[model samples]
Target: MSNEQVVNLNTKNKKINNRQLVKLSIFFTSVIAIMLIFLTNVYIVKEGEYKVVRQFGEVVRIDDQPGLKVKIPFIQSTTTLPKVKMTYDVTEEEINTKDKKRIIIDNYSVWQITDPKLMITNVRSVTGAESKMEEYIYSVVRSELGSLEYKEIVNDEKSSRGSLNEQVTLKVNELLQKNSIGITVLDVRMKRTDLPSENEQAVYTRMISERESKAQEYLSKGDASKNRIIAETDREVTELLAQAKADASVIRAEGEAEAASIYNQSFSKDPNFYSLYRTLESYKKTINDETVIMIPSTSSFAKYLQGNN
Candidate 1:
């Protein structure tokens, strides 16, 4: 080949090589992009979650099974939602009780998504569902608690709290079901109960007063019982004393009668000796250290003193 032919051939070969390199680069770039699209379009569905696939911002399918899931790239998108139980701490609120008392109630609830499609359609998101749940919870709780007294709600020993919680939970579930909210409340519980800060002191004072009044009432009853017992005892003592005195009087009369009979018999057995003894006994009774007496000499009383009997 001549020099001109050689130069043209070299330039043409170089152009062909450049064209092939451009084609190859384009092919590899397309392959890499395709692979990236396929990988990015795939997702994992966990056991406790639901992967919702939406087309054009609308839900088209839901994958709840635990495995690899795919959606059309750039056309469909997937969002995950928990299928397991979730807890929501409800905001504390103040409510009036049946007894016209106000109390602050803090509550919590356990909930689950029964149908993610329905949930997404109605509530749109977990946060939205929780917000709605909270509304129902507060409403039901308020209504239920409003029918109960403060003591029934707060005092554990006298509480109707279990029934209250059940009523609230049931009512909340009913509302959610009625509205097709796609969630169910398994339980609703009152975490804490307290008097409002402004009312606590007043309630405490009133409680103390009530306890003191009760104590006073018991003391009054005890005093009345004690008095009744004392009165009964006094009556019994008086009766016993009177009976004892009557018995002593009867015995004394019997003794006196027996003594009189004995004295009469003794006098009859020895009339002269008995007369002398009686006279001497009378003399001793009438005489004393300062004794002053006057008697007729002819009288029988003077006869003993004069030794003339």
Candidate 2:
């Protein structure tokens, strides 16, 4: 081999070596890129969550089971949704009833995402879903409250006013279900219901007035009853005293009649004896322990006392 041939061969060998190195680098880079894509597309569906796989802004698959999942790199994206129950506490709202009464109502609800696909399709994000829920709840609550009277809404009397809470919950659930917001309503409760400050003062005043009126009525009725009882007792006592006097008079008259009858019978039986008995009675009256007769002889008493005539 001459010197030029040696130089040309050396150059060709170097060019070949450079070409092989470039090929090896390209191969390794391609392999690494493929590996990175594969790693990036892989995801895991955690517990209490559901993953939605989207391709080009369209949902292509849903991973509901807890396991590892793979998708096309850079083309498919995954979104995780909470499968657990969520709670929301709505602020107090002022509402007017059919009876033109204003009241403040505070409420809360427990809900869960039932259909992740529907939730994602209808509402883009969890915050969006929450907003939609609040809107729906507000509308439903307002509508239901508008149909009730103030007494029915605030009264705890189940028999007289009925149960407004049950009706409200049922109506709200039906409305949510009809709208297809992919939410399951677990419970709806009214935390508080109160009258406005001005109205409360008015109610208190009215209540006090009613109580005073009732007290006055009771007092007047009691007085009337007492007077009636006293009058009746007086009438009864008068009647009793009159009857007693009439009974006494009748008894005295009967005794007098019996005594007169007895005296007449005795006089008719012995007129001579009765006369002798009268004369003896007169003699006894004229005589005394100390005999001091200062009578004439013509006098009947003096003759009787001297045992003459």
Each model's TM-score? 0.72, 0.60
TM-score of 1: 0.72
Q: Candidate 2 clash total?
A: 0
Question: Where does candidate 1 stray beyond 4 Å?
Answer: 1-9, 225-309
Summarize candidate 1's per-residue lDDT along 115-152 as a digit string, tens digits: 99999999999999999999999999888888888888
lDDT of 2: 0.81
Total backbone collisions for each predicted model: 0, 0
Candidate 2's displacement at residue 201, Å, is 3.0
Please give the distance, in angstroms, between residue 252's alpha carbon in candidate 2 and its true position after superposition. Answer: 17
> Alpha-carbon error at 1 in model 2, in Å?
20
Best by TM-score: 1
After TM-score superposition, what is the CA distance of residue 2 in candidate 2 from its true location, in Å? 20
